[model samples]
Target: MFKFWYANQQNRVRWANSFSAEYRLECGVRQGGLSSPALFNLYMNNLIDELSRTGIGCHIDGVCINNISYADDMVLLSPSVRALRKLIDVCESYAATHGLKYNATKSELMVFKAGSKTYNTIPPVMLCGRPLNRVTNFKYLGHWVSDDLKDNADIERERRSLAVRCGMLAHRFTRCTTQVKVTLFKAYCQSFYTCSLWVNFTQRAYSGLRTQYNNTFRVLMGMPRFCSASGMFADADVDSFSTIMRKRSASMLRRFRDSPNTILGTLAERWDSPILGRWIRLHAVK
Candidate 1:
């Protein structure tokens, strides 16, 4: 049945109103198909197994996590440059034998350290015989990951995004009903993207986001700048920024705890085991 579903697939290109002749697909799964992601995961299972057997990555409580992946995007983790290079080599060999290719240009190397020191002393990372770009920061899974592992840059970016969304909502929906405006605010302005991962941010940095959040409600309600917004949030049944972040972090922890994924669950439990841990310390349940 599976083979029948994927057999003899035909596709056509639509240019404006004109349609090109249909061509039968000789290889690969259908683009945007419902089963594509699952099929891709099955295809990559062997590669994941091989990498796991290499045992060259961050080790926690006897468990090794060499890579973090979501579909095609992957981040390789290792304690040292040499170990990371070995992981890359293994991946390259697997890809070469499997008729796959790596985009060396899109690949980047980032060295995480304790302090605000420069990474110039660290060795370069090579992929497929080409040097990958070394970056101080990179966006992964909708969040900014910095070399220093600080969340200030990511928080500031989220604040700017929220500010733009607030302005957009106000400009376009000023005449809408209060209830409608509130709905729009919740849909667009209320999202603190990846706030659950904000374990290393300054209070002042987050306070800025809270201020912007309050201003969003003020703009939506047409309240004066100096007017007290003390009970306004509660009155509108909207959670405060801090409360929202806390809830998101708690939700993330719950998902990790409930997930059946062995690798991810092990990693999360290891992090949560410590009293002053990452996911646990910030939103620890009493």
Candidate 2:
């Protein structure tokens, strides 16, 4: 009977989950996921504990160049294959300590500095499903993510997120009267002012809320006067805006604006009073 709603969407959302016993294999540039750190840490911690239980001889946080060495990844130096074997025993024992097991399939062991006068063979094992013979780059955390990759990912992630936010505004954000959603919109607007270079992040956020509430509160509630510009907090660029006096912190003001709590946590901060002048002076000292 209802043509518009029925034609527009389905009543249920069918989700496909990954729980199949059969392996699924696809290869491309495997980008690091957002939750990779927490996941990798859990996996590594298990392996480390397992190796320790087997009476291993590896250092906990290995350091070669004093301060230059990073976390977790270790470099073991030995003269002979026998020494490397001993190191492997240590690794297995360590694994057993934490109720974990590390078979060869999931581990990659590589021998470096082989048959050299100055440097003996250095063997290192990669934790994340690396091939013993074929593995070229090391896995730091869950990614083969290097500093260069991180720099690219940082910018790329930010840009893609902006696009996603724009897409959300383009599609899903149709319904309203959600106090929680309204609060989120208000919070983002109050935190940072984004304008162009990426879906006009700050401006788009404001424009979005207004567009959704075009019927009732758009023109009225969404004003720079009543609604402070996020730039008032983000770019503060005090030199750029000389009109704002050293009255209150831009962040404090922003927080107050976002949160519905009218009664400030402190009695002095609750209301605008002469004591606020003294409070401001105290803040300046610190």
For model 2, where is the 10-residue window of minimal lDDT? 191-200
Candidate 2 per-residue C-alpha lDDT over 126-165 given as tens digits, one digit per residue, 9 for 90 to 100: 3323424423334533323221212233223334444445
Reference-based lDDT, each prediction: 0.83, 0.38
Question: TM-score for each prediction?
Answer: 0.89, 0.29
Clashing residue pairs in candidate 1 (N, C-alpha, C atoms within 3 angstroms): none
RMSD of candidate 1 to true structure, Å: 2.7
In the range 1-286, model 1's lDDT, one tens digit per residue, is 7677668566898899999999977666778889988998998888888889999999877888899888889999998999998999889998999888899999999888857655577777888789888888999888999998889999999999988988888898899998998889888877788887777778799889889888988987798876666678788887777677677877887887799987657856664553227555556553
